[model samples]
Target: MHPVLFKIGSFELASYGLMTALGYAMAAFYLLPRLKKINLDRDTFWNLIFIAFMGALIGAKLLFIIVSWPQLGATTAEKIANIFRDFRYGFVFFGGMIVSVFSLIFYMKKKGLAVFKTSDFLITALPLGHALGRIGCFLAGCCYGRPTDMPWGVTFTDPHALVAPELLGVPLHPTQLYEAGGNLVLFFILHKLYNKPHKNGMILLAYISCYAFMRFIIEFFRGDYRGAFIFGLSPSQTISLLTALAAGALWIYLQKKETKNG
Candidate 1:
C-alpha cells in the first residue's frame, strides 16, 4: 500500500485524497451531461454536489471520531489534535451516505426539484464513484481486513500505510478490494436498472437494499474496532439491517401508492 502517491520536498500528495477527487470527477462526468434529462441546471447541480460533499465529509469524520475515540487519544485536547494531525484517513461510508442523502433532499426541496426523480438519478452514479473510492482505501491501507490464511490475502509493508502496526507484513483478507469489486458490480446492476422504466424511487431503494446487504457481509471480514455491537452485530451491520428494512418499507409504500393511483 502506498499512502503517499508522491512527494516533492516537504509536500506530499495522498493517494486517498487524489483517488477520491478522481472518483468524484468520474461520477460528475457520468452525471453532468444527463442533467438536461432531469431538467436541472448545471449551476444548481454543482451547488447541490458541493453541499452533499461537505455534509458527507463532516458526517463521515464525526462518525469515525465517535467510533475510534479510544484509539485517537487519552485526553480531549490530544483527540482534537489527532483529528487534524492526519486528515487523510478515518471515514464511515454509511455515515457519509446518510448525511449526504439528507443534504441532497434539503437542497432539492429548496430548489424545487423533483425529489424522487433527482435522487434516483443521483443514486445510480454513486456506486460507480464509491467503487473507485474503495480502491483508494486499499491503497491508503485504511479499512483493512482481518488476518487470514486465504491464498489471496494481502500484506502491508509500507510504513506510511495506515494499517494497524501489529498487522504490518501479515496477510489480511483484502476486504477493501472485495468491496471495490462488489461496488463495481453494483454500479453495473444499478445502471442497468436505472435505464429501465420503474418507480420513481425504485433505483434508490435497490441501492440501499443491495448495498446494505453487501456491507453486512463485508463487516464480518473487517479487522478494525467497530463500535459497540448490538445483539452481537457490529455497528455497521446494525445500521445495514435498519437501512435494508427501511428500504423495504419504503418500497412497499411506493408500490401501494402506485396501485392505488392505477
Candidate 2:
C-alpha cells in the first residue's frame, strides 16, 4: 500500500492524512442539512465539532503513546523523541470516541442543546466518516492484520507504509478494509434506524453496541501491538466489551422509561 499519496521534492501528502480530512469533510456534509431538523445552528455545530476534534486528537494520541510506550524505542529519550516524531500516526479509535463524546456532551450541556437528540444525528454520521478513515489506514499500512493464507490477504511492499518490517510483503488479513466494510454496512443500518421513530438516544446506543461488537471481533485479526491485555483480550476488545455492556444497559433503561411513560 502507498503511504504517501503523492510527493514532489520536499512536499509529501500522506494518504492517511488526506483520507482523514476527507472523512471529516464527508461527515460535515452529511450532518449539515440535518442540523436544522435538530434545531442546531451551523456556527454552534461547527464549534462543537472543533471541540470534539481537538479532544479526539488529544485522547487518541495520549492513549496510543501510553499503550505503545514499550514499543516506541529502547531508551527513555528515544521513546520521547519517537513520540513526537511519529505523532501524526498511531491513533486509537475508541480513545477518540470516548473523549469526543464526552466533549460533545459537555458542549451540548453548556449550550443548552438537546444532547441525546443532537447525538442521534451525529452518531449516524460517525460510521460513514469512520469507513473512509479505515480506508486511509489500509493505505497507510497502519492497523494491520495478522498473517493469513487466505486468497484475499494483502501484502504491503511499500517501504513508506507503516507496517512492521517483518510483516512487509507478507500476506495479512486486511483488517482495515474489513472494518471499513463493516462500518459502511453499519452506516446504512444506523441511517435507516435514525429515520424511524425511536427514543432520544436509541441511535447512539445502537451505534455503540454495534461498533463495539464489530471492534471486538476485529481485534482478533489485528496484528498490531494493542496495549496491554486484560483477561486475554486486547485493550480495544476490553473497551468494546465494556462499551457494549454500557450501551445495552442504557438501551434497557431507555426502553423501560419509554414503556412506563406510554
Q: Highest lDDT among the candidates is held by which one? A: 2
**What digit string (tens of lDDT, one per residue) describes model 2 on residues 100-139?**
9898999899999888898998889889889999999999
For residues 1-262, what per-residue lDDT tens digits would candidate 1 score against the true structure?
8889899998999999988888888888899988987888899989877987888798888888888888888899999999999886899988888889888898899988888899998888888888888999999999999999999999999988989999999999999999999999999998899888888999999999999999999999999787777887887899999999999899999999899999
Q: How much is 44 displaced in model 1, in angstroms? A: 1.5
- RMSD after CA superposition, every candidate: 1.1, 1.2
TM-score between candidate 1 and the true structure:
0.97
Q: List the candidate 1 regions with Cα displacement exceeding 4 Å.
A: none
Model 1 has an lDDT value of: 0.89
Residue-level error in angstroms, candidate 1, position 237: 1.1
TM-score of each: 0.97, 0.97
**Candidate 2: worst 10 consecutive residues by lDDT?**
226-235
